[model samples]
Target: MPVVTVASLKGIYPPIATPFADDGTLDDNKMISNIKRWSSATRLSGIVCQGSNGEYVLLSTDERVHQVKIVREHMPAQWQLIVGTEAGSTAATIDMTKRVAAVGADAALVLTPSCYKSRMSDEAIISHYTSIADASPIPVILYNMPANTGVDLSVAAICHLARHKNIIGLKDSSGNVVKMATVRKKTDKNEFSLLAGSAGFLLPALSIGAVGGVCALANIAPQLCCDIQEAFDTGDFHTAMAHQHRAVEINTAVTSQFGVPGLKYAMDMLGLHGGPCRAPLVRLTDDEKRKLDAILRDSQVQHTERIHDR
Candidate 1:
């Protein structure tokens, strides 16, 4: 049985970066420290351990499970814990989902299987999510990351899956507000939660009824991200727009432009344990680091300590 049941998925949740040591092994100490720091720094709704920002595709099955266990053990009970359990096959996805559920994750964020993109039709996509959700011990949140997965879950298919008893919500990273609004209109507002997968257009999505965001920007600037949602929730659109504009620049830098390496570097700059990305995802160049530093400074992301010796 799943240990946590996420009744409401409204608020900011950071798709946390996986910290690796210089030797390329998981740095448990650093990861725990990062979790501790994030918990204290902001009031996030939850923490996503193996989402895209976490470099989920790079980790082995066992490593993914271990990451969730570590996060579950340390995270505050008030915060929901969601783990990315996406796999290439439905059977594999279900297995991973169950594994994470056993370790205490409240829900599984399963990405669309795009290994055979040509065959991932509407019927195929619906079946994939339906089967996984049917078997998952915990509720499943559909992950639509067309940038990485290549296959986008159409609004029609999403509306269909929204009816599933076990499938609860979506994390749409496509940045298509039109499609998001359409899906929002077609689904049951009470039963389905729509989460923007990027902070780039979080306020717009929220304006169109998105519950919150699961953003890479939140990894370094969690309070800022949360503030956007908080301000909007309280009808302060002016304040939310101000935060949203700043978030777009920073979000683009860490996500679409520089990817995981840039995000880890940004985390390091903010005095968290960002360490290194796994193999193949190299460290940022000096020029890239300088650019990222300027962006963070400009965005006013708080840092308890300086990136360099002060």
Candidate 2:
């Protein structure tokens, strides 16, 4: 059996963005500071490390493992730590999973292996996840980030993977609630968790039996994201829709609209440590930043409480 069942794995988790200094180096101290503030967000369930938002592709193997160790040490114990140990090869992923589990991660978030996109068949994906789940010391969460990987895990693939006791859940970022519902219908809820990959569809995802979200918007608006889930659970659709409406634009701005650069900029504006992105990804221009600022102001996410230790 998995360490924790999907039933217990529901809530808003931020796919933490890896903080890099101007020199393109990991700033562990800065990241630790950010995690401390996130600890104060209302109803925040856990922290997700090294998903797309974490810039997992840009870091070295050593850096990925090292950051997981750093986050687990600093974040609150109550928060579950789900580390993304995704690698193109199954052997590499399995090796990384064990390393993270040794450090204190609650679960491993494994993305689809898309380097060989053409050959990533349903059978291939099923084999990859099953093999990793069998070998991993901790339970595994299948990550279906089609935007980044260009390979969406089919419902058939998900249903097959869900049967593995160690393969606990999925984070579907395709934003297709219909597809999400189909997966929910085919799989046993007790055995599988369907998490909204982004906050854009978190409510709709939940409406169709999703547990929660691993949202990029949660990185900027933790309380806002958490409120959506909290409101919906309590039968307050009006407030939930209010949060969801705000989430739609903010999520689009950070995720599909501007990608990581815009997300980091928004963090910097709101007193968070969303500094530079690693090379191959550039920062936003002055005009783009102005537009983002306007959007934020319009949505009333103008400022945060701004936490700091004396």
Instruction: Give the per-residue lDDT digits (tens) of candidate 1, residues 194-251.
Output: 9999999999999998999999998888878888999999999999999888788888
Error of 2 at 110 (Å): 0.7
In model 2, which regions exceed 4 Å deviation?
Answer: 1-3, 304-310
Go through the candidates in order and give the C-alpha RMSD of each one to the true structure: 2.6, 2.1
Candidate 1 ranges with C-alpha deviation above 4 Å: 1-7, 303-310
- TM-score, cand. 1: 0.95
In candidate 1, the residue pairs with backbone N, CA or C atoms under 3 Å apart (3 or more residues apart, or in different chains) clash, namely none
Judged by TM-score, which candidate is best? 2
Total clashing pairs in model 1: 0
Local error of candidate 2 at residue 308 (angstroms)? 14
Candidate achieving the largest lDDT: 2
